[model samples]
Target chain A: MNTELVLFGVFAVMTLVSAGLVITARSPINSAMALVSTFFFLAGIYVLLWAHTVAVMQVLVYAGAIMVLFLFVIMLLNLGEAAHRGRPTVTRILGGASAFGLLAVLAVTLGRTQALPAQMSAEVQGKFGTMAAIGESIFTTWLLPFEAVSLLLLVAMVGAVVVAKSRI
Target chain B: MVPITYYLLLAAALFCMGMFGVLVRTNALVVFMCVELMLNAVNLTFLAFARMHGALGGGPNAVFGVGHVSAFFVIAVAAAEAAIGLAIVIAVFRSRGSVNVDDIRTMKH
Candidate 1:
């Protein structure tokens, strides 16, 4: 097998397994820890896709800052092992059925698309997914969205502080 | 070389898992984590499509196409969501003394 395929297999397995743990682990802290691992593996997949900038941001934001917030809340709340709820109900069963049904439809649709080229062309392999390319486009063509996102971040920061300040 | 469809399929599976988690888990924090998972899955799809379109060489440096830009925006939004979301979770915990979604039903009454 090719190296790229091998890498994809490894990362895909790791990501899915860790994601499963995130939802299945009893303690919220354990779930958060699982989520950290999931982000790391997902970043690996991003790198395989040649999205180097996104991979870096994934590590920095999701695994680093966001996870810190999750862990902090889990601790502050002092959440014990989630009390075992009763048996799954009809709504739960229906939700599962619908989610799986959606997945099936998505899979079928994707499978029907024309097959993509097996290997990236040299020109794209060289320049695509590079930070320079992304930065150029972000500043030149996508400048407005970039500015808007910064503003949104500012608002979110202020709002979070205000919301969390009441108890402090 | 891996097929782009493989990446898409993987993303779909991950998204399904996240959806399942959201549906089954009653804990608000775990549900939020599932939401994050769903977002990441969507990011994977974006990057996969970016790679595919860039390979077409439609323009100079089209490799880092609009998909990358959109994915970046998604990540930024996710960060903001996490911040605000966790803050809400904390506030809820303080008010109700429980983080379970079932315990926080205010609209029913």
Candidate 2:
């Protein structure tokens, strides 16, 4: 068995299991913790895909920043006592059915694809996921989008402050 | 060598689970987390395609491609989304005294 494929399987299985926990855990805290682990494992998968920079950012942003925000909000809301795992309603049942249906279709479509060459020339691999390489592209070809995103983030920051401090 | 399809399939599964949570979960915070999951799923797809097509070089030193750049854009956008979304959740909780979505349907509140 190819070591890469084996590692991929391990990370993929772990990621799915963590994600399942994220949705099913009774406490929002538990779900947030599970989501953090899910992000960690997904970062592993991203590295396996030769996206080292993306993987690092995934860990830093998703696992570090995003999950912290999630935990903060969950605690601030004092939802620990509201751990009422409500009885599954009809909407939940339908949701599960549709989710499985969607997965089946995706499997069928993606499985039909032929195997792609997974080997990257050493030269390419060296340059492929490096921070410098990705950054170069971001500042050049994607310069406009990058600036727009910074502006968007600024707007979001201001908007969040205004909304969250409504009564203050 | 893992097949590219495996990555795509996993991303699809992740996206589907996120959709399910968004549809069925009543807690507004959990619903927002699900949205984050969906965004991550899309990011995975972008990186996978980026790897497959070798489209990520743009400088004289780097080859030219948009996949990695696209993933970066998605992450940036997701951060902004999370900020605004959580603020809304917080404001809603303060007004309604609960973060349950079912209790949040009225516009006049």
Candidate 3:
């Protein structure tokens, strides 16, 4: 068996299972912990996709920063085990059906793609998805968007503080 | 080498799970986590496509493909979204004393 395919299967299976746990865990803290594992597994999948920088970001920004934030909020809220973790509600049953339907549609649509992976030389593959390559692209081709995102982050920081505070 | 279709299918499955969580989960924070999962799925799709077509143009130079760049932007946006979303959740919990979606049905309370 191909090593890459094997690795992909492992990462993909782990990611989906953890994500399932994230949604199904009884407490919000359990869900948050499961989400962290899901992020870590997704980072593994990102590596398989040759996204080294993104994989690192997935671990750092997602598993590290964002998840910590989630944990802090969960603890602050002091949420306990869900009181109504009972039989599936009508809305939940409908949600599962629609989600499954969406999966089927997406599978059919992606199945029809006749395109194949573009072959790249060893050197190009090395350069592709690197921090340097992505940075160069962001600085030149996507400069405006990069700057806009920086601004958005700043605004979001201020907005979050303002909104989270008890009063104006 | 693994097929790009495999990655795409995995991403699609992940997206579906996230959608299901967002739709069915009642806890506001869990719903927010589901949104993050969906964003990550899209990022995976972007990288898979990048692997598929990153070297279309000028060989080595074309390594700076749109796919990676798009994923980078998505990650940044997701960070911003998380910050704002969590703040809103905290604010809502403070006011309502509960984070349950059913309890948070009113805007004025």
Residue A66, model 1: lDDT of: 95
Error of model 1, residue B81, in angstroms = 0.3
DockQ-best of 1 and 3:
3
TM-score per prediction, in order, is 0.94, 0.93, 0.94
lDDT of 2 at B1: 73
Candidate 3 lDDT by residue in tens digits, A1-168: 989878988988999999999989989899999999999998898887788889998898999989999999988888989888535778879988999999999999988875557788787777878898888878877789899999999999999999999978
lDDT score at residue A19, model 2, on the 0-100 scale: 83
User: Which candidate, 2 or 3, has the higher TM-score?
Assistant: 3
Docking class for model 2 is medium
Tens-place lDDT digits, model 2, residues A52-141: 889899898888887788888887888874546545878778887898899899999998997564466677667777888888888877
Tens-place lDDT digits, model 1, residues A1-168 = 999999999999999999999879988899999999999999999998889989999999999999999998988998989887725889888888888999999999999986563366676577777888889878877889999999999999999999988855
Off by over 4 Å in 3: A86-90, B58-63, B107-109
- Candidate 3 on B1-109: residue-level lDDT in tens? 8888888999999999999999888889999999999999999999998888867765334346778888888988999999999999999888888888877656656
- Write model 1 residue lDDT over B8-83, tens digit each, in one string: 9999999999999898888999999999999999999999888776646445533446788889999999999999
The native-contact fractions of the candidates, in order shown, are 0.67, 0.62, 0.71
